[model samples]
Target: MIGVVSNSRHASDYSQGVRAMADFARKCLDNWVLTVNGSFEQHQKMIRATLAKRAYELFELRGREHGLHLEDWVIAEQELVHHNLNGNSSGFCILVDCPRDPGIITILSVTSRSLLVFQSRAMADHNPELIAVHLLPENIHPEQTAVDAVDGVLQVHLPKQRNKRRK
Candidate 1:
């Protein structure tokens, strides 16, 4: 995470810490550098470690402001897909990710309830690879697996659904 860097120890410099960290993370993603060879498994392992490191780096960079941990925030993959709630042919693309594979970023179909919903770690905890709510009409329950990315740390499985709603 690289953003606004401070030259001296001033109180205001401390305040821009968030922006600085955001810049840093963006740069890391944009200019991510990795070198490895061998089996696909080996390559994925390296990517997984890299993703985890970036997540922790983000947490550390922002520690000066919110005092948060790596797990405290939601680490959604940057990809987005279109979502349809009203059964419209065309859908709106929103930034969201499956809890299971946070790295294989994609959009989702959320009802009005989750329209503007941004997830926290509490929400993504063990979320299934939400490959579109619009499942195939005749598909059976398939097995779980890690995301196909540089990192393979994507958690698989949806959160347990409860009959009770949040109060």
Candidate 2:
């Protein structure tokens, strides 16, 4: 994946590393999921693998009901060993296996985090009398949002698809 940034005064190598991590995430999600404990390096690794896996899979699971083989995707994991205060040096690091939405992904493997997210989304989406967009969770900043303190299949509505009901 390509890296996007608008700051030259930031850690350029680190930003590049972030993209590299995203690329890795796009490739080896499962492994990254298993790793990535909480350390910055671990988080970067998981991010890369998650990005790699999701972008690669696009969440399609039709062929595997009867048992289809999954592909071993590999992202070009380049090293970012530079750190400059004024450059914002950036790159990708990867753990490969862990994901925020493991339930949908766990069709290929079984993981607790993925399962929880998948189930949470599925329930929110399936619940009727509720707007669809609200069903999908959002990454609120500062640990806050309009739906603060909401739980049990949250009903969030996206502005673009108002009144639309998701499956």
Q: What TM-score, to 2 decimals, does candidate 1 have?
A: 0.21
lDDT of 1 at 147: 20
> CA lDDT of each candidate?
0.26, 0.23
Best candidate according to lDDT: 1
At residue 55, candidate 2 shows an lDDT of: 36
Candidate 1: tens digits of C-alpha lDDT, residues 1-167: 11122223343322222112222121112111111111233223323443444566566677645645444333512221124322222222222233453333232112212221112232333221222222111211121111222332222221212244789
Please give, for residues 1-167, the per-residue lDDT of candidate 2 as tens digits. Answer: 11121323344443333223222121222211111111244334343544444434532444334322233222212111112112111211111122344332211111111111111232232211100101112221211111111222221111221234788
Q: After superposition, which runs of candidate 2 have C-alpha atoms over 4 Å from their true positions? A: 1-38, 59-149, 153-167
Q: In model 2, what lDDT does residue 86 have? A: 20
